[model samples]
Every structure is written in C-alpha cells, then in structure tokens.
Target: MGASNFVQEMKEVGERLLLKLQRLPQAEPVEIVAFSAIILFTATVLLLLLIACSCCCSSCCGPAARGRKSQVQPMAPR
Candidate 1:
C-alpha cells in the first residue's frame, strides 16, 4: 500500500512536470543546434577527463617517472 502510494505520487509529479514543460516555448533550430553542441562538448570533456584519470591512477607517480635510472647528459653549449 505504501509503495503504491509512492508510485502514484511520482506519477502525478511526472504528469505535472510534463504539463509545465509542454507550456514552454518550442526550441528554435539555432537553439537546438547550440544545445546539441554544448552537450557534445561536455561529453567530450568528460570522456577526456575519465581517460586522464584512468591513466594517472594506475601508478603512484607515472610509469615513466618511476625512479628509473637515466643518463645524465652534459648540456652541449649551442
């Protein structure tokens, strides 16, 4: 009974939200394109951030920076 009541309330809220949204002005083609571009850019940025985090989190520092011995080359005077 409680669950049914909760579901009914959610349905009513959804219907009300839909009615409110229907009253809003329709999107112009330019606005639609702009929104699409914004969403695409946001998704791209999120994907890049996820990739960077995955790469960075794999090691304490990074694979290249892991205290490996390197040759100390004397800088040649140009």
Candidate 2:
C-alpha cells in the first residue's frame, strides 16, 4: 500500500513538471535576429579596424613616409 502511494505521488510530480515545460515560451525568432545583429556588428568593427591599420601602416612605412623622416632626422655637419 505504501509503495503504491509513493509511485502515485511520483507520477503526479512528473506530470506537473511536464506541464510547466510545455507552457514555456519559445524564442527562436528573437535568437536568430540577435545572432544576425551581433555577426553584422562584429563584421563592421573588423572591417573598420582593417581599413585603419592599412591606412596607418601604408602612410607610415611607404615611400611617402620619407617625407616625414627628414623632419625627424637630426642635423649633420655643415
């Protein structure tokens, strides 16, 4: 008799748990939109960083860099 009562209690608890889970709301669309926005933002930031690095490196290390080099060089013998 006691064993049957325990089994019945467990079954009731399981049903309640399943009902709560079934009532939970889904968020697939929201998740997809958020993921896409994050990806786009990350890509834009990476592109901007790449462009900035290229501009700085080229202007500071290319032939044109020679123009600024003279300004920083120390004066030599007359």
Candidate 3:
C-alpha cells in the first residue's frame, strides 16, 4: 500500500525471478539441430501429400466427362 512496501515487494520478486533463471538446466547443444531436422522432415512429408492428392484428383475426376458420354451412348441404342 505504501511506496516503500511496493519497492520492497518488487525487489523481492526480481530476486526470486533471477534465482529461478539461474537454477534452470542448460539446454543441450544438439537441440537446435534436432529441431531443424524434424521441421524439415515434416515439411517434406506435407509437400509430398499435397502432390499426391492433386495427382489423384486430376486423374480420377477429370475423366468424368468422357465417362458420362460412354454411358449415355449405350442407353440410346436400347
């Protein structure tokens, strides 16, 4: 509530934060390399999946126009 009390509280909070930061374990050096490899692999897989879907859609759906003509011809002779 008072200015001194507020300043003391802030100082105590800052010290606690600094202590916690110092106590944290050091990160392993290989973590960045491993993370990069995982990201690259994921991007490659997503690109491959997009290409496959596009190929399948074009091959299977684009021929529907030709397929409808053939089906209609058989019914006309009947």
Candidate 4:
C-alpha cells in the first residue's frame, strides 16, 4: 500500500514536471548546452563540498581526545 502510494505520488510529480516543461519556451542548441554545463558544474561543486565536509567532520577523522586517561588498566600476567 505504501509502495503504491509512493508510485502514485511520483507519477503525479512527473506529470506536473512534464506540464511545466511543455509550458516553457523552446531553447536554442547553444542555450541548452550552456544550461547543461552550468547544471553539471554546480552539481560537481556541491558533490565535492559534501565529500570534503564528510571527511572533515567524520568521527574517524576527528581530533584525538585531550588529556583523557584510560579507565581500564592492563591485565596482570597469569
């Protein structure tokens, strides 16, 4: 049921997008190429920033704990 609802929503969104596109004026070849390039460049920059942020802010790459002592001492030899 959830899947069907999701599909219906997607279909509606697709229909709306198609209608919007149809209402838009046709673009020249040069304009289309320029628009595509701009979109690609923006996407590339955003993706790169996302990757950089993840690497910088990730726990695995974060700074080490300062002045924290381990509570568990080493086990005595048997």
Candidate 5:
C-alpha cells in the first residue's frame, strides 16, 4: 500500500512537470535575448584569446620557423 501511494505521488509530480514543459515555448523575450548575447560574447572572447596565444608563441619561441637556430642548445658530454 505504501509503495502504491509513493508511485501515485510520483506520477502527479511528473504530470505537473510535463504541463510546465508544454508552456516553455512562451518564455519571456528578454530572457531569450540575454541568453543568446551571453553565448555570443563567450565565443568571441575565446576566439580572440586563441589568436593572441598563437601570435605570442611564434614570436617568443626560437626562430626555427625558417633557417634560424632554436633556443635549445646541445650540452657537451663529460
């Protein structure tokens, strides 16, 4: 009997959630705009950071790009 009661309560809760989900498409417009803006801003910032890192690394590392010796040096064996 207790198990049956619990199952009925769970079914009622699930039904309520289903009703709410059905109305989800009518959410506030401002919320939709804000969410979209956040996504765009995050993507733009990540892309800019990646570009800056590549540029900085190429310049800081040895000139091995063409015909220059890298910063690495060979050690004399003792």
Candidate 6:
C-alpha cells in the first residue's frame, strides 16, 4: 500500500539522520561553530522575513481592516 511505502521511506530517512547525529561528536569544533552560525543566520533571516510580511500593506488594505457587523435584524410580532 502507499502508506507502507511512505513508512519505509520515513524509516530510511530516520536511519540516515541517526547516522549523521552519531558522527557529529567526531566533527571538529570549528565545523560545529560554523554549522551553528549558519543555522542561527538562517533562523534570523526567516524571523525577520516573517515580521516584515506581517507588518506590510495586507494588514491595512485586507478584510481584517473591517469590523464584523451582524446581518440579522429583529422581526416584528404578527
């Protein structure tokens, strides 16, 4: 089944990640620092982009600018 194939692929990916983690301890300090710096830089860039998008024109011109108004009105008794 397709699910079984997806599970097998996930297991393979997990194994590969585990092998990489096991090898991490043997890596040089400089390599670790460089990798850490790269990760932090990527995180910073992504966070800045997210903040910029949230603060842009969409918040001013989009549907969010309008207040919710009720559509129903009270009916008179017959």
Q: In TM-score terms, which candidate is top? A: 2
Per-prediction TM-score to the true structure, in the order listed: 0.44, 0.49, 0.45, 0.46, 0.45, 0.48
Off by over 4 Å in 2: 1-27, 67-78
Ranking by lDDT: 6, 5, 1, 2, 4, 3
Global lDDT scores for all candidate models: 0.79, 0.79, 0.75, 0.77, 0.80, 0.82
Error of 6 at 78 (Å): 53
User: How close to the true structure is residue 44 of candidate 4, measured as C-alpha lDDT?
Assistant: 100
Off by over 4 Å in 4: 1-25, 59-78
User: Which 10 consecutive positions of candidate 5 have the poorest summed lDDT?
Assistant: 61-70
Q: Which candidate is the best by lDDT?
A: 6
* lDDT of candidate 6 over 1-78, digit per residue (tens): 999999999999889867866877898998778867876998999999999887886776668776554689899999
- Name the better of 1 and 5 by lDDT: 5
Q: Residue by residue across 1-78, what tens digits does model 5's lDDT show?
A: 999999999999889767755765786887667756866898999999999999988877747655565588899999
User: For model 5, which pairs clash?
Assistant: none
Q: Residues 15-39, candidate 1: write the lDDT tens digits.
A: 9857745754586777667766866
Better of 5 and 6 by lDDT: 6
**Candidates sorted by TM-score, best first:** 2, 6, 4, 3, 5, 1
TM-score of model 2 relative to the true fold?
A: 0.49
Q: In candidate 6, how many Å is residue 8 off? A: 18
Per-candidate clashes come to 0, 0, 0, 0, 0, 0
Candidate that beats the other on lDDT, 3 or 6, i.e. the better one: 6
Stretches off by above 4 angstroms in model 5 are 1-26, 62-78
lDDT string, candidate 4, 1-78, tens digits: 999999999999889857755754686777667767866998999999999888877745555533344688899999
Residue 9 Cα positional deviation in candidate 3, in Å, after optimal superposition: 37
Pairs that clash in candidate 3: none
